[model samples]
Each structure stands twice: as C-alpha cells, then as structure tokens.
Target: MAYVIAKKKNTDEKPFDYLPKFHTLRDGTEVILDYYDNQDEEETYRILKDIVDDGQSYPQETMETIQEFKDYYLSHDAFVVRQAQTAEVLGAFYIKPNFPGRCSHLSNAGFIVKPSARRKGIARFMAQNYLYMARDLGYKASMFNLVFVNNEGSLKLWRDLGFVEIGRIPNAGNLKGVGFTDAVQFYYDFATLPQKQ
Candidate 1:
C-alpha cells in the first residue's frame, strides 16, 4: 500500500508518516490497517455492503453494490483493517470534510466493523489511527455527525477517547426494529486533547 504524506499547511512536518502498518489485538490476532487500495476494493465493498444490509447502526437504507461503493470510497480518505493471516477485511472507515470552504478544517468520519469482528478492539484501533491521520492532514478536529443515542458502546468509546457531545437531534434516527432514537453529534478538538502519558 502506498502511504500518502500530508504536509501540514505552511509547515514541513509530516506527522502521519509514523502510522503503524499492523496491530495485534488483545487475543494476539494480527491485523493490517492501511489506506484503501484498488487491489482490495471488491473485498472492502463486500464487507461494507454486509454492514449496511444489517441495518442496525448505519443510517443508509439501501446497501450499495460493489461499483457504487467503489465510487463513494474513492472520493474519500477510506481506510480498512484486515486480518493478517487470512486477509479478510474486518473493519473500514472514511474521513471527509464536514463541509466546503471555511469549514474544511473540521472532518466527519464513519465506521463499520464486520459482525464477527465486533467488540474485539478493531473500532477503537481504527478511531485512534484515524485521529492521528486527521491531525496530520490539517484537520483541526474530527466529528461524528450522527451517532444513534442508543448505541451505548460507540458512545462510550468515543467519550473515552475525549469526544464531547456538541448537539443532539431528537428522534432523528430510525433503528432497525427499534423505532426512533435521538442522534448525537460528537466532536473532538485535537488542540485541547490531553497529552498521552
């Protein structure tokens, strides 16, 4: 995979160059995390489609076909986490500008983990890595645009990572078989984040 070196505007540092290529989970399972590569497009689409079809967390109703998925991911900084031994895509995410000019310093991100891979630290790993990449890419902060209020696990994880609830939209999400729930917007400012010990 080709790593992109993003130079912070008006500066010479490329902090993201230090991103890790592989991570070992608590159970000793090795996984590779990297930018989206054309070679893995089909597999990545399959994993994302399955997550959308499940219709539990994501907001989209219809799952995209492989071609459509490819088009969408190509327009964003999409990343994937894959099992090292079998090369199976365990999770995926994408980061994009939250809005056009003047607001481009703020980014929005979305994540999906295979059903079999949930609760295995893949989400946390992806979030941490993405934040590092975002910071290096000149994003002042990262935001979760619409986190369903009922998703306690995601809420807890984001909060633990220092994301704060900035706004809430009541009854804005229709969860599968769960009717309507509030959607929350969470934000994390890289500047004020506490230093890691």
Candidate 2:
C-alpha cells in the first residue's frame, strides 16, 4: 500500500490581494489603496482627528496623540486611500470581526473620508473595496454596526450597495446639535451578494 500526505496551506497571504494599489476616480484622480504604512502615520492621524472633531459621523472621544491613532489602526484590518500624486491621505477604513468565537464569521467595517474628499465618490469606492476585502478575508457576512439614522447619505449609500437594514437601536446616537438619533444596523450576506465583475 502506498501512503500519501497532503500539504498544509499557507493562510498568511495578504488580506487585500483583490485590491489594486492604484485606482482612478471618476474625476480622473489617481488614488492608492493599501495597508497603513508608518511613513504615512502623520497624514493618516490628521485625517482621523479631523473626522472625530467634525462630530458629524463618527461618535468617539478625542485622540490626543498620533500614537493613539496608530494604535487604533493596528488593532484592526486598517487601510488608507491616498492621492497617488501628492500622497495625501484622503480616506481610511478598518474591518474586523464583529465578535469573538462562533460569531467571528461576521465582520464589521468603519470608514472615514476627509472633508475635501467627501462628495467625490470616495466613500462608494472605499465601500466597494471593503466588501471585496471582507469576502476575500473569509467573512460570511459584513455589517455596519452603527449607521446613524440622521446620516441620510450613508444610509442611502449602504442601501444602494445591497446592505439591508437588519436592526435598529433607538436613540443610540447623539448627533451634534441634533439631539438623539437612532442607530441602524445594516447587514450583507456574501453568499447572497452578486460578485463584482
């Protein structure tokens, strides 16, 4: 009798292999999307700090130092989208498991785009890339844990991208100058979603 052994697979490949290093926006601006690099830490931190300060989308406390921001990025599968020419960090996002143990198959993602970068399709581009990354990372589903109801743009974008409102937490978020608002949870199942050509 002959004995055969199977080879073990390498599971440490880059997570964002499906994404390109350079993507051209609708306005013809070339943007680079990749994992965060230490060299771009300052620029990335600036963008995140601005978002936290804006108080329009993300809910959070202040990041007093760059190290704090860097540590936050390192805690998740973080990526930055930047201007290829000027190397300006336009947007960034992080994807991670929604919970530990059996629920780990479900992933969650958060996004932040600079004020100058908004209304220019960056969010849509980042979201599309995020879904691809999530699928490639072996996540069965993706969810935006907290999409404020007052954020009509995001709610509309997520819906248009095939995400369904799975649940909602009433008065879960306090929008700046707008009192309390509901936080809607959106979900997308990879098996049901059509692959992007």
Candidate 3:
C-alpha cells in the first residue's frame, strides 16, 4: 500500500519554533497558543490528570507522576493555550503520528481544555492551530481514533471544522460511571481544508 511521510520534529521538549499567537474565543476572550515549555508543565499536567481521573474523555485513566505525563505528552509536538494577559493555562494539545514510518503522514492529536475554560471556544481555537501545524509538519491528514459518542461538544466542533465521521467503535470508552460507551472515529484531509478567507 502507498503511504506518505511526515516531517520529523526534533526529539526535544519543544519540537517546533512556533511564535505565540493570539486568538479570540467564541465569547470574545483572547488566548495565546504556543509550544510546550517546562514552565507550563505543572499546570498542564494538573489539567490532564484531572481529566484522566474523571474518566470521561481520555483513554489513559491515571497520570500518577509528572514523568508519566512527560512520557505521554512531551514525546511529540505539544502545545499549550493560555490567557493573553494573565498567562493562565487553559488548555493543551499534542500532535503525534498515528502509525510508524511510511504511514506517519497520518497524524493524531489529543486536546484537553480545563473545566473552567469550557464554553469559551478554546478547544476550537486550539484545533484550528493544530490543523495548520500538522500540515506544516508534513502530515497529509489528521484522524481522531476515539471520540466518545456522548461528547456532543467535541463531536460538533470536529464536524463543524470539516472532519467527517469515518467509523465507529462500540463500547470504545470506559467512562467513569457510565461504563462502556460508544465512540466514533473522525478524519480530515489537509487536501480539502478550506483556506481561511
């Protein structure tokens, strides 16, 4: 089978030299997106750890140590979003290859927006930046392997951003109280990404 290769980033904490950029959320709040750094590590880990313990979205259930967080998130191209003025981290994400070698052009990403930052459009903003960054890193497409069906907000956001439902897995998410729940897979090709007007 034919495949594509994605440009490799330096195997360091910060893979790309991305300039901090400000974006307005749905409620007109401004947030800055930039590469992950050691300074922001503590706060970001707290956010992700909470989500993992909550058992609603992420697959990994526990992040017991900062090293575990590093091994999982920092191994790839990771970024964080913070409030422009206060510099309070509100969310973070990481883009990594979905497969090895020749299939590395197919990228995958995971996002975490703190509960307090929800409803302000932080996720969408991060997603927009992620798409461009993925393409810039030579990924031809991005695919989300598991999105719980009950996550209406994320489902809506991905669909609105032009991702299509490619497949579904029954009982894919072992949610906290709900037990096994249905999950959907989503896909997007950079080829069809509409140029921002």
Candidate 4:
C-alpha cells in the first residue's frame, strides 16, 4: 500500500487578503474593517482586557500583559474595526488553526468589542469579515469550542449567521456570578457560505 501525506499549507493570506471594508452602523457611525497591525495593539489589548475582566464571554480571567494578549490574539491572522472619524479601535478578531497537522484546515476565532461600543453592530461586521478571511486563509471550516450558553448575544449572532450546533457540553464554564454555565459548540463550513467574494 502507498501512503501520501498532506503537507502544511501556506495560504496567500497577504497578497489576496487584507480587503478593507467600510460600513455605517445603525446609528450612522462609520466604521472601517481592515487587517490588524502594530498600531492597533494597545487598543486591541484594552478591548480584550475588558472582555476578559467581564468574565461573561471569554475564558480567561485576565490577560495580565499586552505580550500575553498578543500571543493569544495575534498569533494568527487578525483583523480590526475602527471608527473612521477618530481612528479608534472599535473591535477586533483573530482566525487561527484549531488543531495541528491533518486538522489544520479547521480554524478557530476569537472576537471582542470595546465595552462602550457594543450594540452598535460591530460583532456582525466582524463575523461577516471573518468568514471571508478564514476562507481566504485556506480554512475549510470554522468552529467555536466554548460558546457559553449564557452568552445570548453571541449565540444569537452565530445562529443568525447559520452556524450549526454540533454539540453541547454541560457545565462548560464557571461564569463570574452565574455559577456553572453550559456551552454549545458551533461549526460552520466555508463551502456552505455563498461564494460572493
């Protein structure tokens, strides 16, 4: 018998990527969605820190330092959404391989919005951008491993975007004040998305 193994893939994440998007939110706030860069570090770190401190969404209790935040948030392809007028970072996200070797085609993502900027539709914008970016980065599918059951906003968003609940884990998180929380695993195949891009 002959065995042929698959080699790691280096996607055209740069040349064919970084397609910046501009949009107006419900309240007429102009936001620009673009590739993340060095200048975005501080604000992204702050946003992530706030999310971590909230203890309602993210898994971490605290990020500790910017360096630690970068290692987790910026290790793979990341993007940021900024307010066009002031250039303030509104939110950001990252897409990375969920597993190594043969499972590299499956990607995972994390997202956060400035606490003051929630309900402005930033999450929807990032979610839309993530699908295209993940596909462009050569991922076959995207999965969220620990979406807390109490995270109604995220649960609604993911479901609205057509993500399927593959499985549910009981008592998946110990939320700050919510005692034990269940979580649902979400999965979305890139091929299921419309190839408009």
Stretches off by above 4 angstroms in model 1 are: 1-15, 193-197
Candidate 3 lDDT at 160 equals 91
lDDT of 3 by residue, 95-175 (tens): 889887877899999899989999888898898888888888789999998999888999999999999999999999889
All models: lDDT?
0.78, 0.79, 0.87, 0.87
Q: In angstroms, give how far residue 145 of model 4 lies from its true place.
A: 0.2
Q: Each model's TM-score, in the order given?
A: 0.85, 0.86, 0.89, 0.91
Q: Highest TM-score: which candidate?
A: 4
- RMSD (CA, Å), candidate 1 to true, equals 6.1
Q: Candidate 3, 78: how far from true, in Å?
A: 0.7
Q: Which parts of model 3 have CA positions greater than 4 angstroms off?
A: 1-18, 195-197
Query: Candidate 2 lDDT, tens digit per residue, 105-144?
Result: 8888778888888887888988988887888778899977
Question: Which candidate, 1 or 2, has the higher lDDT?
Answer: 2
TM-score of 2: 0.86
Candidate 4, residue 187: Cα displacement in angstroms equals: 0.6
Error of 1 at 65 (Å): 1.2
What is the Å distance of residue 60 in model 4 from its true position? 1.1
The number of clashing residue pairs in model 4 is 0
